[model samples]
Target: MNKLFAFFLAMLLPVVLFAQTPKMGEFTQNEIDLKEISYEPGASAVFLVASGESRFFSNILETNYFYRIKILTEAGKEYADIPIGYFAGSTNVEVVSAIKAQITTYTNGVPEVTTLGKESIFQVDLGNGYKEFRISFPNAQVGSILEFSFKKADKNIEFLDGWSFQRSVPVLFSNYQITMIPQLEYKMIGQGENFYHRSEKSEGNGVYSWTLRDLYSLKGEPYMKNYQDYVDKVEFQLSRYQTAATTSGPEWTDHLNTWEKLGDELIEYYSVRGFYRTNPLEREVLSLDLSKGSQKDKAEIAYYYIRDNFINEGEDLIYTKQTLPQLLKSKKGAPGELMLAYMGILKSQGIECNPVLIGSKGHGRSDIVPFPFLNQFDEILLLVKLDGNLQFLDLSDPLAPFGYVDLDKHVKGGLFLEKNASKLIPIDIRHNSNKLVFSNIKLDTETGDLVIENTIRNYFYEGLASAHLVEILEKNDKPLEELFSEKYDALEIRNVKVDDLLEDKNMYNISFESVLKNAMSEDLIIFNPLQISKFATNPFTQEFRVFPVDFEYAFNETYTANLVIPEGYELDDYPTNESITIPGSPIGFSYSTENLGEIFKITARLEVKNPLIPSSSYGDLKFFMESVSSKLTAPVILKRISIP
Candidate 1:
């Protein structure tokens, strides 16, 4: 009860209460000042151990919002000491000071980490004279807690509204989670601002925290402006690691000199480390008979091979180019490696195969720049020259029919990656050489409703549906559901069957039937949507998108829709029965409706006689689509029958 003791106890009480608010704490005794210093080269398992690690798993995404990343090793060395590469280009925006380190570790072990919880794994502002932040970690285990936010204060630039963060280096995680806190006070400026994780009070200066706990909704990242910038910056900054001189120039003058030197060094290093080998079998194991098989046939075979053996490595490295032989026989490979292997194998078989760079569905284009970032193209696939047309083959997609690459990876804007050279040029792979046959709809004048049936068969349709059927379903069901709703209000889809005729051929048969509530209604409620089958808005319409229109395989389609209308309603008008075909364009749209006693039978078809619409002729292709879309909307008018 003495005054001296009482004072000490009062001070202790405030200390306990202040710490209870969950202010972030330092895991290490020392911290690096961010303003004074920006990066750490390598990372220590011990350092991250103190910070914690995450091993979270997800079937849908390869990365997460938990944007915390660190380097684990240096060129062939156990990085016990954390180096600068471990923290290069890493910046953080502060979030809510927690009463406790909110951490979630996916697993535990010395080198194994998948957790994402704890304040130790994050960078925090360590009070100094100037603006500065610091973070330190020990040899971490999996499932470490992490929190990060984007801030204009931290970086010179303000937050971009549509900006999204992606992995600088591609990685396959067991799971991914990210907690992003928005500073509404600093409103992001741009289109799609409505998107970015915002709080309930969307239009204010509020600090709200959100986390990508599962990353279930994110599309696999394509190329990003900042992500590419980061990569370019990193590549440039780390020129000491790669051949920097190769950064510019049409072709490196004796460039392989550095590549060759590196190759020789790698050969020697691998020899010492027991990782080097020359496999004759690798060069010869897989062979493509491209010269002989029809493009469709080649597509079919590749589709089946990839679908069945798609080793779900997720974003993990399956087989590097150096390990092609092992991957060929193992029947497991990276998306790119597998694609190249198929090309090589086909080449061995006398197939005219080429490696084509794909920009994917999300972003990037095939535009050229002197110091262009290779990340512009995140996907690689094979293209075969058959007879004269070019075929886009995603050998990584087994479910994709011979003719189609899924829409995500189906961006047709690609350049070729050739050996000992980088001669970039546009590749035009399209939907042509195929046709569709339609059977029309008939209405019964007795009832106010009508029944219809249509069958869709693709001679060759390949893309997103075939390959990412699972991924699409796993990622977002709303888009698919919405697409169906938009197509038909009273539609019933059935017998959705996809087929592969042989190891090298593919086909699909879909029978859909629908009944409209007011086919005979006075208002033009009936929207006869000759449905186009793709998850994405065939964004390839003629006017907006200038890229070549890509159709999987040229195929013929036949649709039969027989409709029975109500007694009071009958087919009053039919689309001016007409059909048109354009020269050099593979697609044709045609439809006609007829009236008989109490029945209206209608038939229509849109066929692609070939794939690979050339860019030089993109305008014609767009016009063809605009015309088809226009004609498809022109419907047979259903007039109400007057009572006698």
Candidate 2:
């Protein structure tokens, strides 16, 4: 892919000039005296001007970057240190020029400039073939203006990092200009919520420029998936190029424009098909007894056999680093390699399975564009047909149950690699993460105390998370009571019993006894019936959200409590029965109460049917969560009755 991108960039090289490029070290009065950005008033720092100019010359692509920032507050002083990074291991890319930085401060309207000296510049190796050039601006302070400029040259033109108009700090003006030849055709993809100005000049060479002004800083919100998915940015992909033709018509070459061709190339270059054909695990597969059970049962045996036998090195890579035989001999490999071995075993037993390439949750959205960009995917899962049903399996997590896909890998779709049938397939898992709680409470009139017995059941992903937490706590020699106490405030817990935690089951159970002190106050008793509250406080604190809220997966939390009212007190006030649902969505919440003679039963369930909620529905979701929190934490009041 890198070579192909480099070739396309080489074809775009021509003598071109950009007149709109900003000159370094120039600052306007408004930028110098800027106190805060009008759009983003709370921003500590603001980018006054950010510009980039790129051109291919002499078989090398050189990009010049200029940035001017104003530090409005003390926290903004951290911007004084800037680190420019590049892949040092790649000979094709390098920092060809020295970095220049200066800090400008005003004293009674008089501008004073301090230039960065060579002593303040240093280099650091960031491991994994990466290195960073650190530049420390001299005498940086609040209300100071910092300016920096550097040139980066890449022999591999595919290293075009494109441009991001918006950042964590507000950007007043962000511009990027690229010079290209007419022979090559490139596809430009722009994303985010911003209007941009685009212009093209053709003076024997093509000069394309993009300019975005006054872009607000994209702030991170609760439950946001990936910042890159919503940040204002532009990317370019080489689509087609014209070749010197010897025949009657000119020839145009397609550069990975189709998913099918990209899949074919991946198989060919990575030797994926070769590994399948060679059956690297044939000997191991033959040793396993497979003729005893049904296809699904056999698949389970094969999955567990590979999962239990092989050690995962904890890397979520798509390709295998070692050969199958080498991995088998070592008994340890990356998740992808082990999955491949599992696939080999399944294939040997005539089971239907294929590798699915996916971009995990933190990797950003997979369907950003229709273009076949291979870099979009960072991990691979197995798509198998068992009992005529499709299931996605990720062996990355050792404790994850069979047919369990990691929550991070629960993307909208994945590229199913099945020879000629390779295509994008939806990832629909029927399982949900749920937590069920049943609490029995008794109020003591004399001592003003409440005794509670709670039983909690966690299913699917929730159970896996609980199991991991249990493992960690047990490793540290901490009692399970600590977990319960930390979770429920103002409660004393005892007699904790955990079941099916380390076992390979879909659900885990935890039962414990707790006492809530001071339930009665003078003539009244106030208590919260819920033993396990999902939301103690509203997660959606921000009034407005620019990005979608990703809950990771659909979840359900049900809390059922039976409170035995004391003989001296009668129920006076309780949370009213109410049901609320987001219109046109599956998200809902309900709280109901029942009076059964002396026993008061409270049932509440919070169901989020859709994990990903769009920003447009954020207000409703926020309101719903606020209501749920209020109802769950609302105290049940009981007034003392005079002796009759």
Candidate 3:
């Protein structure tokens, strides 16, 4: 009798453990009765349970995912329509079988479940070798609990997807489990692991698991580069694998186990190293007259020659899809190919340069983990050593200056791909005067209108961006006044003129006139001194920030306004001269006003010598920005004198 009872208890133990794990089409009373998460009081939705498991079956890697969410508000209903995306162009991974989803609601303590039909699942082709399978829960409402599950199969173990514990909504419980086989070795990289509630490893069965509870949602801040970089997540990379060679056993092979090994692999790749050896544009490069300028000047000439001749296909890819010959013949190629061709030309002219791999801003932080993961990078830029100075150039944009790198690609550092010396190097971002505005303001005595003449100068990256905008407007046959009108909505812009557009200079000038109607009343005239204020509003409005603020580059914005008082009006009130600075930082703002009998001169200078502000300094930075905004938008009041 004792033996029989023990056998029955063992059989029931497996069922109890399986029931503890969240399953599809099942909900507890507590989950159904939940109205809102206590920790996240303002959250629209909450993830009740999010779990995933991955294991190898018959040498094939398969992963299963399950998510249960509780909708607490009208906005939470948007989560009912879930879209799962996968790379359909590759033979590596695929969505297995159909997705299962259900919506559960309770009425008067009685539960009702509505299942999603197979025919309701929609497939959307998201171009560029990607597709999404979308599923919507039936009868979803504010109090509905939406649950969905799906499975994926991967033929190649190298493409293992990482797990994110946090999402845009609060998560109550999250778990991830993985079972590893003895034939392969994987290195685990984790971020925010300190937040984990349970981390267990069963070495006997090669099973690893991590769990987190009551995690707040991740929200974007003003100057955050990418929220994904700060999320709590874990990823696995295949470090070593076993291959069948002999009848005795499988042989172990190292795969990207170190940064040096990864560097060597990238050098041997056909699209990178082969392109340099071939030098398809050698003939075209020799025809140019590069003999007149210095080495730096000659490098700039070659940069423009390639930029103007070859059209960019507008794709940000690290590896080129076509050979150098194919690209040169077609006269157009991806940005990587064009940059490589530019490198070849520079090398022929005895210029020193190397290709640098960077993960763009949208691609997340390049150096988040210590592991040298190749997938982390997506863009390549040319780093040239000229005149004893290093210059980073993004040849993708024709309007970009010789030493200009796009703000999105301005990473802290990147992998400098030099032959046998490939390693990470610090990127010294060059600083240039970004914007300067000078405005002359006067009141039209007869019409009671404010007349303003403004001259705006943009330099470096700012100049390149403005040039691109002007080119686009010209291509569309739009008036330049539209730019100012959109910016200064309270004024009417006219006689707009742009200078130095598409020229060799790294700056452009814009001059325009504006008229503000009814700016003056019978007794008083009120006007804002700065017509082209840099800060329309304080950008740091959030109470707290989780990520550092990246302003991309250091810049100086100087605004000078000369106001000529009306004939019979006298200054009653004006903005006071003030200065503010953040302690221990190179950020400061100053506003000064000079009251000369008839002319009022106002000058405001905002200097941000350090572009990146750490999250710890967000409060001081926010206050500083708020002060600047208040000073720039302060009103200057004038009164009309009555002769007794």
Candidate 4:
């Protein structure tokens, strides 16, 4: 190996290096061998390479201790149950103890990693400029029998292989559910990119094609209000990636020092001598009291002003120097500028309006503390106080009518105030307007794995939300198909109940239950994970995930899921049904499970109680959320049915 390889390989060989691989576990490939990464469309490819098949095993180790490839096969290519290791290593699959964290990367948002287990590490000689290595995981805990499928498409591997790669496990996970099977990510592009991705399943199409977190174990326990304490713990561990200070944010002690020392450099904008006055249009909005003008007349007047006075522009132009005056003079503009100009006209006519600021999904979060991280604000909305109620207007998000926000723009925390102000305080508001409720479940089984299904309907938020997810899973929540093969062999899903049908608020409700056959025949089940997540079983789940959850008004929703047990199984225990009220708003959970019909009956009531939870109540609000989440994972055991 060269000096560069010798240097990095040596540096990264201690954590889980195991001799030939890098211990740091860089989540993605450090270098790309153009020749190795290639693909062909509509061509046949055997992605399920047989075990002990090639020299790739050793080369993979040399690169980092991790090597995984995703082949884009022609669509409709059929394959069999890939022979992944029954367990990860040389021995009978390591079982529960085998799949724990050995090493990890990441300390914050964007990505995270959780190593379930590691199998045999075999180093091999890759012919040509390539080398390889192989490591397997029994992966007995993955969704739906651990089927890592390769999508067959009419694309070529000639860097048909050319695709994005992340640093997480090699599995397919979409926006909501992880897609182990090839559900199709990129299809015929160009004409179809926009049209095809319109489905909810496709929202996370490309998102779930790979792993969620990188190999570096870089992700942290989900966000909690005690983010500082969590960050301290993460920084203490993980020798590879280290956590840094948050500058002037709440977590830091001497935030000002850290701010000036580590924050982004500010650019000075000095006024030039050529500054000119704004040439604004003389337009006025007359919101003739509904009592004053006919509904048709009011709508006609609004439509005319929108059509004749505003110059339509694209998303990019909306953020440029297209000031209100510029758009007003042209009597035309994009969403932001147009809204500003529109509000200006309305204000001129004394209609009264304000600009609402929100942080888009990927723009980080909007917690308006003293320090200003303008980058966090990625979206804007027009708010008008009419009859003491604020009307949400997102001219940028075209389909959001005039009273509601686009799904992506509807976040939990943001600032809304009269436009001409620098200081910001909390403002009371409502958004999305959909309510949500779910049930608690306890599955008593003879084995560790089984198929699970839950159906959902969209009523309030679902009807008003403009998201591909709400659209596809709109009529029905995605079909449930999670059954770990190694853990359990057979399973079934039944009673997919859904109601409250609608076309506009497209309201629907679904009720379903899961039946699992456990692998262990012991009189007692060790641990049953009703929901799968890294901390799905952790007791401190509540303390770790405290970010305000935005159900965004789903309309007083309610859900009841019941689990039917086998004849021999009986409920040994259940979480006591209890409800805790959060002050300032209606939000909490109520649940109970009892032995009924040779099966366990559990009804977990997850109610938003109300649409909006004030930030002042954030403390109790977070605690309540965690309490319910924790209750959801409360376990129950199945005793062997035997009598003298």
Q: Lowest-lDDT window of 10 residues in candidate 1?
A: 232-241
lDDT of 4 by residue, 296-380 (tens): 3343344345645455666622143554455555665556566555555445434445555566544433333234334335556
Q: lDDT tens digits, residues 535-578, model 3? A: 74788887766667877778988999999987778889998999
For model 1, what is the alpha-carbon lDDT of residue 626? 63
Residue 600, model 1: Cα distance from true site in angstroms: 6.3
How many residue pairs clash in each candidate at the backbone level? 122, 0, 0, 82
User: Residues 547-642, candidate 2, lDDT per residue (tens digit)?
Assistant: 788777889999999988787779999989999988777688899999999999999998888777887898888898899889888888878896
Q: Which candidate should be chosen as best, given lDDT against the real structure?
A: 2
Distance (Å) between predicted and true CA of 296, model 2? 1.4
Clashing pairs in 3: none
Query: How do the candidates rank by lDDT, highest first?
Result: 2, 3, 1, 4
Residue-wise lDDT of candidate 1 within 129-211, one digit each (tens)? 22332333444332243323222211211121222222222221212111121211122221121123321122122222221
Backbone-clash count (model 4): 82
What TM-score would every model get versus the actual structure?
0.43, 0.90, 0.85, 0.35
Candidates sorted by TM-score, descending order? 2, 3, 1, 4
Error of 2 at 346 (Å): 1.3
Candidate 4 C-alpha error for residue 198, in Å: 47
